[model samples]
Every structure is written in C-alpha cells, then in structure tokens.
Target chain A: MPAGASTRAGSILAKPDHRYAAVSILPSVLVVFAVVIYPLIYAVMMSFRDSRMGVLGGFIGLANYARLFSDVEFRLAIVRTLVLTVIAVALVIVISLGVAMVVNERFRGSSFIKLALLLPYALPGTLSALIWRWMYDPSYGILNAVLYHTGFIKEYVTFTGDPRTAMGAIILAHVWKFVPYSAFLFVAGLSSIPPGLYEAARIDGASSLTIFRKITLPLLAPAMQLALIVQTVFAVLYHFGLVYIITGGGPGRATTTLPWYVYSETFRFMQFGRGSAAAVVLALIMLVFIYVYLVALSPKERTVS
Target chain B: MRRQDTISGRRRRKAVWLALMTVLIGMYLLFPLVWMALSSFQDERVLQSRPPRVLLTPDIFTLDHYNFLLTGRMPETGIMVQAMYTMSGTYVLPSVVNSLVIAVTVTLGNLILGIPAAHAFARVRFRGNRTLFMALFATRLLPALSIVVPMFIIVSRIGLLDTKLALMVIYLAITLPFTLWLLRGYFAHVPRELEEAARVDGAGRFTVLWRIVLPVAKPGLIASAVFAFMLSYGEFPFALILTQSLASRTMPALMAGIGYYGSSRGMVAAASVLSFAPPLVLAALFRRQLIDGLTQRFE
Candidate 1:
C-alpha cells in the first residue's frame, strides 16, 4: 500500500474497534503458530533420536547429523539436487526473460501466447509430471516416436527409463512448469520500464542490444530477484512432486534430489531418525539459501518500484 | 533511401522473429496437455504401438476411456489388473469430488480466517503485528519436508490419517498465510471514505465492513479465493501422506497410485485429462485475476 492511501484510510478508520481486530487476527495467528512452530520443534527433536519404522527410540545426539556427511547416498542426493537446482534456475530466469520480452511487445496473437504460458504454471506438478512421463515413455512415448521418425536416432530412445535422460526429463518438466510464473512477472517488469527511457535511448542512437543491456537489464533486477527466489523455492528447494511422479528417484537414483531423499529415507529405508535429520538439514540449507539470496538481492527485492 | 530501406528491413526481420518465437512458446507450453487430451481417446493398442499414431482418426479413436471414467463400465483395457484399475478408475470421479470438497472447504477457511486477519494487519495497529505477519508466512519459505515428519506423526496420533479432515486442516494452514498477504494488500487499499460515510449514516463497524468494504474488496476476495482453491486443489505431498484410499484421496494422489502400478498409458492419459479439467477450467476462467493477484506488488 502507498503511504498516502494507508494514512488516508487509517485517518478515518483510526482505532476501529481494537477488540474486533484482535479477535479476527487471532485465528490465523494461532493456526500458524501451532502448525508451524510445534512441528518445527518436534522435527528438531526427532533428528536427535534413533527412530525407525515410525518408532521412537533412545536419543542419539548428532549421530543423525554426522551420518549425513558420511552416507554416500545422502551426499550424492545433495549433489544431484544442487546440480538440478542450479541448472533449472538458470534456465528458468533466462527463458522467462525471453518469454517476458516477447510477450511485452503487442504482436498479433500475443494475448493468446500470454495465456498459454500461464496454463502450465496453473497445472499441478504431479499432473505435469505424468504428462511428461507419458512423453518420455520408452516404447509408447511421442518423444521416442518423433526422434525415430526424424532420424535423430536409429532406434527409439529410453528417456526416463535411462539414467542419462531421467534427470534431463525431470528438469525439463520442472522448468516447463516454473518458467511461466517468472515470465509473467518479467512482463510486468518489462512494461514497468518507463517507455520514455526507450525513446530517449533510441534518439541517442543506442542499439536494441545496447538498450537491453543498459536500461532494461538493470531495471529488471527486482523481477529477476523475485523470479530467483520463487524458482529456488519451487524448482530446487521444496518441489519434490515432479520427481515423485516422473521418476520416484529411480533408474539407479539418477534423478534423486534432496527432497526425494527425505521421502525415500523415511518411507523406503524406514529410517525415521535419518529422514527427520535430513529434514532438519534441508531446513538449515534452506535458511542459508534464504539468507544468501536475501542478502544478495536485498533492499532492491523489497522495493518493486 | 537506402538507410530507410535498411531500417525497414531490420524491423521486418524483428517482427518475423518475434512471431516465430511466440508460436514456439505457445506450442512448447500447450503441447503436452494437448497431446495427453488427444491420446486419451485412442485405443490401448494404438496408443502403445511403436511409433504410435500422433493423429486421431475415426478408425483409431475410441470413447472407451471416457466411457470408463464418466460411467463405471470398464474399458476393454487388456491388462490383468483390469478389475483393480476398474475399481480404481471408479475412484477418479469420487476423488475429484474429494478434491472439490477439500479445496472448497480450504477456500472458505482462507476467506473466513483471512479477511479479518488481513483487515487487522493492514488497518489495526497492534503490538507484534509485523512480527506475527512475517512468522505466519515463514513456513512458506521452507520445504514442507522439513516439518512434515512431525506433522505426519501428529496427524496419526490424533487418528486423523486417511481422513479428509486432516488434509483440510493442513491445507488451511498452508494457504491462509498467502491469502492473508494478498488480502492485506487489498484491504489496506480499500477506500476509507466509504466506510466512514457508512459510519456517519449510523452503521456499526461490522455493518460498515459488510456493506461498504466487502463490495469494494471483491477483487481481492476473488483473487484470494482462487489462490487458495488452486493451491488446495493441486497440493500433493500431504495428500499422499494422509489419504489412504478413495475415501479421502485427491486427484493427484489417485493418479499417482495408478502411475505407481504402471497402469496403461491410454487410461493414465485419460485419467490425466479428467484430473486436469477442473484446474484447467479455473485457470482459464480466472487467468486475469490470478495473474493480477500474484503480481499485485509489481505495479
């Protein structure tokens, strides 16, 4: 809210029944606290105990944390997750920038294109993964049929069935769902770049490329920051639904990200302590990411204007 | 004349390039869903054939998939687990109903909890206001996996597992904070003069808010409602954890269960289409509102 609007609104609505205000706010406050704070503390405690098969055992004190370092599967899962996150985030930002750039221009059928882009963002990750899984199906998938028909390969290729393509498959699906959101944000960012600057640059004989590099890019920093934050959360940090649907961390754990590892550890391996420990570590890692991203993107991220 | 021609030529090339890119982006985004929709109508054998037919013809397509989904009659899917999948296929509509109920309940929960809370945050000056707002939304920043273990245990201990109530409660928590964010932004911006005018006419606070504020805040309400609905509808992990069967399972969970068993590609595609319909419709209808709400701060 602008300061003017808020102040104006506040002036008339001053002390609008503080009791009513508190009563209304209390439900959301209580829910958030009870649901989040309690579970978070419990997760911390479970990380210390030797819980297996959903059974709580004696306290094990940092053993679960220590084990995260030495366990090769866990280590590999972290590495795979980082690789996927880094690559996916890069693609999401760049592609969304391209998308936003194009969509910002009022060309024929641009409105349709804009709506098309948002369709994927609106689709569920699991459903999106299922669609891609069909596309990647070895014998029956359209991808294989297309590649074979086009003479890209002599034989149909196994996408998710093969270790090499599984990571790429999930990444593609993940990126597909993620890019539109950032694209829409970037379109807003692009239009928000006052048109006068563009006219001025044009009069000054700046090339399109130069104008983009100079005026457009710097101005897009806020949207870029937002895209980065959202992508990191959905693409790398929290989203396991895509992987869960498409691969289930299979084909030799080729697509196993850390989030998947948490599910795998708890359910498949039945090591609740380790899974909780992994969860705790994942939270800590997320904190570091939030910290670094905020610190790096800071002040600018807050001020959209 | 040559300089003018050169500049015109450059502009033409740029326009063509943009046009090409626009079409490609459209195809890239829409292809998978379109393919899934078209493929669902194909015969199982036709769908499974090596270098499967991409286009549908009268000879190739069948309504068996739709028949099985819309009605309880089994399609002639030759899998040995026909009985199982048929039973499971019947679950799709019911699970969809489950999703609708839960999502609707979650949306209502969001509005009921969100409106007043957002109003307070934006208007009512209180101690710890900013702090509470931040803390409420803090969980959104982290992965659900972090706290899901304890949440899972808590749900089970309370014996709410495999129940829709568990999902409804969790989703309310998950969605309310974000709804609060959007609604607060909205309520803060509602014109105060109208409410004051109502007050001058001798209306109470609740009545003023009801009569004056709500109508003005309708856009915010719609946006928040749609946001909560979409999130609740598409949510996966908790649905996977909490729901045991069609009794409380959502569309995504049911689809996942089918995928796990390696169900027929044609039928799975059919299931995907059925499941995608609701959100797809919602997205198509509320695309403007959803986008505007999400990018509210952008302007």
Candidate 2:
C-alpha cells in the first residue's frame, strides 16, 4: 500500500472498527492463550511439587529443580541437548546454504534435484532414525558391509551402539533429514537477492568470492537468522523422534538429551516433578525468553513497512 | 581478450564443480531412501546376506511382507508371524490411516480457526494487536517437549488417552499457532485497496474476506493445510505417549515401535516405504505454493 493510503487506513481504523477487529481476533487469541498457557500451567505446577508415579504429593517448592540440577543424568542431558543442537544447526545451515546456492545456479535439470530435496525432510523422523539405524547396525547392516568391502574399517563397527560415536551418528541423521527444508529457506533468500547486484558486481571487475562475501552473504542475513533460530529450536526439541527411535537414549545413556531425560524421568521413572522441572529448566523456560526477543524483532516491522 | 578467455576457463571449472557437487549431494540426499525402498521388495535372506546384497531385480523380489501388512496374509514360518504374536507388530496400514485421520482433522481445525484470526491480524487495527500477534507467533516456537509431559497426563486423566481425539487437540495446539502466523503474513500481502473499495461499496467484512482476500491468499491456505497435515502426520512424541494401540496410534509411533522391536529388517523396510509416500507426493505437487508460502508470503 502507498504511505498515504495506509495513513488514511490507519486513521479510519483508529476509530470505528476496533470493535470489529476485537470480535474477529478474540477466538484466536483465546485459543492460543488457552493452548499454550493451559498445559504450561499444569507442567509448571507439577514441577513445583514432590510428585511420584502419577500421584500428586505436597508441593516441595523448587526441590524438583534442585534435584534435577544435582542429578548427573539431568545435567548431562542439558549439555548434550545444547551441544547437539548447536552442532547440528551449524552443519544443517552450512550444507543447506551450499545446496541452495547450487540449486540457484539453475543448471540443466536442477529442478529434478529440487524435487528430490523434499524426500529427506518429508520422510518421518522415525523413518530416518530407522533407516540410519540399519545403516549404522554393526552386523548385517549395509553401511558396515560397504565399509568392510571397501576396506574403510578393519572390522564392523557400531555407530549408534558405541558411546563415543553415538552422538556423532545421530547428528549425521539429523543434518541429513533437516537440510532440505532450511535449504529451501536459503533458496528463497537466494532468489530474493536482486540479480542486478550480481550483474553489476561482475561488471565492476569483482571476483566471484568477493561478490559472494560482499553481496550474497550480507543480503542473506535475515534468512540465516531465521534458519538459525528455527533450526536450533527444531534440533533441540524435535530430535525426540530421531533420538528415541535411533538410540533410545542409547547405549548406557550415551545419547540421552533433555527431551529423553524428560521422557524417562516423568514417564519411565514416573518422577513427574523432576521430569516437568527438567522440561521447564533445561528447555522451555530458556527458549521462551529467546522467542520473546524474536517476537519483538520481526514481521511487524516488515509488515508495516 | 584475456579476461574473456579466463571467464570461459572459470566457466569450464564451474561446470565440472557443479556436476560433481550435484551428483555427490544428490547421492547423499537420495541414496538411503532409494536403498530402503528397493530393500522393501527383497526377502530377508537377500537383504541380510553377507555384504548386504541390494537386489532390485524384479524376478528376485517377494511381496509377502507387504501382503502381510496390507492384507494380513501370514508370511510362512518366519519373523513376521512371531512379530505379530509377540510384539505389537506390523499395523502399518491401519496406523497410516490413523495418521491420516488425525492430520486431516488438525488441518481442518487450523483452517477454520486460522482464517478469521489471521484476517483480523492482517487488516484490523485493534488494541494490543502486535502484542497479541507476537505472543501467538512465540507460542508456535515452543516445543512439544514443554507441553508433552502435562499434555500426556491431562489426556490420560480425562480418559482421552488412546483416542484420536487426544492427538487431535494437542496437534491443533501444536500446529494452529504456525498456521495463524503464516496466514497473517500472507493476508497482509493481499492488497488492502481492493478490500477497502469493497467495504465502501457496501460488501460486509466477511464478504470482502471470502471474495477478495481468500482468492488472493489461496496459496497460503494450501501451504498452511499441507504444513499442518505433514507435522501432524510426522509427530511422534505426543502420539507415542498418548496412544497405546494401533486403533489410534499414528504411523510414526507405530513405525518407531516396529523399528525399536528388532522386527524383520525387510518388514521395517516395507513400512518405511509406506510411511513417506503421502508427504513426499503432497510436497512435490504443491511445490510452488509451499515455497511461495515461505518465501513470498514471508515478505
């Protein structure tokens, strides 16, 4: 819209239709509030108690939080979740950007590969976990078979079974499955970078690397930021399916991240209080503040402009 | 002349690089899936043979495992029978239906709720509009991790556990925020002048929205619907926790159970092929709108 038109619209909106807006928007606001806050309140309240095995005992008031902080498994799960999310998000971003850059080149028959991109992201995470688990299987597994035949390893090795390599293996599956979606984000970013800038840069005697660093990299910041945030949230939280299927929190708690801990603590051990606390302390509370900052920073500025 | 020659040389180098990267990345993106789909057709002996022979030869394959899954045709004296007897096994087809019902319901739920809410966010000026919009967007970012613990308990307490209704409500909560935020962005991009002109011409707000905004925002609607369906279909943790049987268990939850149970490798392979088809087909068909929804509506 023109600035004048928007200003006139703003003035018209300033008085009469506030009621209309309220009426229209109320159901969604209430729905989001109820959906988010309702379960949140239940979890938060449960976390403050000394609950056990589906039984709500007296409120312990931060005892669950204290216990989770002291427990080695809880503490390690937090570190593992953070580290894995960081590493996975970084790898996914870099790989997706490369894929996106290649896709943007519009080389012969690239659209076929573009369609292929959706396969990894579209497949259920459990299925990826299943496929990768088979690939990583020590005996009777394709990966071990290929490596042994090709002489990459002296013997069949356990990828998800060994404590040392389990996280690395999970991270590989995570990157493979996640790259395509965010790659599309970067493709969008690449498409939006005006072609004239690159044309002018080429005409100005700039090198390819220089053009990329000066124009492409900087212009892609919004997409990069969004991907980084979204993928971080995605990796930290949603890898539940992947980890649950692939390692089951692993060979001796080796791959147990925060979500796994939450599951085991609440559901497995029936330690509801501790589980809820692990969820709030390690994951949700920290992410809530980050999301609030994101909300402040985006969309409204772009939409109004 | 020297610059032109160098440019052609760079072009040759890039073509080689592009081709190499394309093949390498394509292999990485596709090989595992193609391997799995191919493995689905083979019998256990062939798939698990030494060095794991991946035979796609049409004459060498068997559909017994698939027949077992789709039609309950028992595989003769094998793991499939034991798997069915021992574990909660191979409800692949039924679970896929369970996934579809929950996903479709959630998608419909999102559209019904999302359209009006998003419309108001885009066109209406009300008190606390940005604050409300921001909060809703933020909720979408909150992981199922936070909500699942309590959501499970609540569902169980209400005796909704093992019901598709449990999955539907949670999925609506899980997915609706995203639909609202994306549709809001799409609605904002719909030209306001036409809407304003319609309002002045005495069409009611709903009429303007249905006739004008919706037609323009069709891409976002499809994108939102597909997005909801995929997420609901792929959702694992909530479904796993809430549902115990194939009656309401989704494909992911059931597939995970099969994988975890050390079921026949070929059987798991067949199920993996079944699970991924819908989302991939939907994505490929709606390739334009899905990308446009993220890239164009995002603006």
Backbone clash total for model 2 is: 0
Q: Single out the weakest 10-residue window by summed lDDT for candidate 2 chain B.
A: B80-89
Indicate the TM-score of model 1.
0.93
Error of 2 at A40 (Å): 0.9
Instruction: List TM-score per model, in order.
Output: 0.93, 0.92
Model 1 lDDT tens row, B104-219: 99999999899888877877777787888877877787688787778889999999998888889888988998898888888777877877677788787667767877788887
DockQ of model 2 vs. true complex: 0.59
TM-scores (chain A) of the candidates: 0.91, 0.87
lDDT of each: 0.81, 0.81
DockQ of each: 0.59, 0.59
Q: Between which residue pairs do clashes occur in model 2?
A: none
Give the per-residue lDDT digits (tens) of candidate 2, residues B101-174: 89999999899888988898888866688888777777766667777888887888889989998788778877
Best by TM-score: 1
Error of 2 at A270 (Å): 0.9
